[model samples]
Target: MSKANLSDNKMSATCSLSEELMALLPQTKESFKLDFSEKVEKSVVILLHQARELFYEGKMNECLKTSETIRDYSWEKLNTGTWRDVDKEWRRVYSYGCLLKVLCMCFKTDDIGEAIRVCDMGLLMGASILEDILVKVVNVLQKHLQHGKRPETKIEELSKKKTKSDHTLAPAVKLGTAVPILQCPSLEFFRKNYLVPQKPVILEGIANHWPCMKKWSVDYIQEIAGCRTVPVEVGSKYTDEEWSQRLMTVNEFISKYIMNKNDIGYLAQHQLFDQIPELKQDICIPDYCCLGSGEEDDITINAWFGPAGTISPLHQDPQQNFLAQVLGRKYIQLYSPEESESLYPHETQLLHNTSQVDVENPNLIKFPKFTEASYQSCILNPGQILFIPVKYWHYVRALDISFSVSFWWS
Candidate 1:
């Protein structure tokens, strides 16, 4: 159906949409009452109630303005402290603003594609609230388009540019030490040999069968998830004073940071699979994760996508990690937990897991013992997984434009 048909049948579409979307209001109200009542600022609570009333009265513009006010209030609370200090009340309030804003956009706009983009904006920026109601709404809108119940303007095909760099790939670092490499070892062997002793090993061939090895290219990611919003870390590493985070569409992140490479932007440590489930279909959880806890929900998967030269400063994680390289290569160095004293951990609670010493360029005068700490290094290639035992001090740097998934389990 052509988009022009929408004006003729606009009233019918609007009427039917009211019936469908109005059903979600009661659920939204109940969630807000439960989570926000007597908890958040009075102004926020009042605006939320006002937004709901406006929405029910078909005053979408008023509702949108009220929702923006609520969002602004919540964002102030969010920015008062660091990202770690953002509490559930603030996130819920912010999410409600997004929810209300998306609903208003959907109700007022004739363009379904623009409605989807609004939903994506919320999904990219909002925290997990009300069982991810935004995701639910997006699914519903997408179904309407798929069933041809609503006419949609064509989505222009994004430029499928190759991730070629003008700069030459840096030579792989050689540290005179290497983690043991295992080729598709049996689960039994992996558990008894490596998992039991809490040793790190690079496992090859296990991930070779995954579809991501063949299907995931820079273009493929851009095609599938380009429109999606993501939190990107901007700077060479987080430990730098100038380091900061920004939220941008994946397409913008790719063009501005990933491709250009003048400034580094890393989409690091984000649970992207939960946000975009279609991308999750391209890979499977490693069977080895079953060795720990044996429960599916206990596992945490994060996506690390960035340009060459993006660095993860030396840090230790609390859970065991299976770092899988889906595309490009990375140089990873690991130090045992026993060597923590020599590695010079930061004094602050926030950065206690991170080493004060820069592994690549150490200041031997400030921390003379850091040079004496033993470590293992490897150039992790595509279709390979590196097992990092809990509290294993690891430093990572991308050797090329890279996309890696990490599965962390207890």
Candidate 2:
């Protein structure tokens, strides 16, 4: 059905809870034993329920006003309590208000991006309950969006245009050279030279002491992780239409991808350490993580295992990272946050953290600005750790069957 018709059907649904919502307002006002603050809380609950009824009754403006009132009340009255206490009631109500307001904005103003931003904020605030509802709203907006205006579609079009123009007009341009390599730099030296400057660097001796360097081979990994089911990336790169994810046993992954190079199957970004304690014993977190908030346990360790030629497209992570190459080699390219615009980061919410430009092969015609973006590259070899600062764009391609561990902290 059309969006308009779907909306109309939703509007036609009976709002039977209207009377119950109205009844709560008077009960809240007349409760003599209740404290003023308790009364206000009850009133807010009633108001939110009333707003939901109004929304079902097609009173979009009234629903929006009620939602805003709840938000304002929560902001002014509930900001003083401890987070553990406040999040139980006030935060949930506040998130509900935000969700309703965004839904109204989507329906009334047709500002899908604004709606999405509000949803992002809600999720960050821990409103996981609204995830399904938010997804449905985004799907509705995507379906109704004008042709060629959707972010992913627009990016695909730009990629095609660049490909066509590459043959006729602009010549290819190189991005930049390799990242500087340091041997066993001290924690202070690393913090001062690389972390502080937000520069990418390769450290040679950091992972030499790690037991994984000697213990983790294809045979050992297959024996330990064989039966465990894992989420694997099934494509060469995420930018392709055929790209997808699959779940399979580690044994199957090893046999299909590692033993024989049939396709680019990768165990990318899986928290293998958390899932397998035996594997965790093989590696240790680098000492430089102490430079952060000192919450050593808060560090997230992920495993990247894949066959030769598997590609991880240009993407950025939100935390400082130590990528330790335990087995085989990988070619990595990195760009600083300052060069984001030049790289043409994906405008779509889904791929917002990824770059549109293919780092290995640039289509200079459509993304000519990418030529101006300076980048650092490196070939991460066994027992080497590459420090990638937060929000730095990095791309990776495995030169051979590889197993790497990454620690994200900060």
Q: TM-scores for all candidates?
A: 0.82, 0.58
Predict model 1's lDDT versus the native.
0.79
The global C-alpha lDDT for each of the candidates, from Candidate 1 onward, is 0.79, 0.70
Query: How does model 1 score by TM-score?
Result: 0.82
Give the winner by TM-score: 1
C-alpha RMSD of candidate 1: 4.6
- lDDT tens digits, residues 262-379, model 1? 7789998556887777788888899898888758887888999988888899999999999999978899899999999999999999899999998889999999999789989888
Looking at model 2, residue 10 earns an lDDT score of: 48
lDDT for model 2, please.
Answer: 0.70
| Number of the top-ranking candidate, with lDDT as the measure | 1
Candidate 2 Cα deviation (angstroms), residue 147: 57
Q: Estimate, for each residue in 211-315, the C-alpha lDDT of model 2 and write its tens digit.
A: 888898776785455545567888888889998978666767776666554577889854556545678898988988999974998898989998777788899
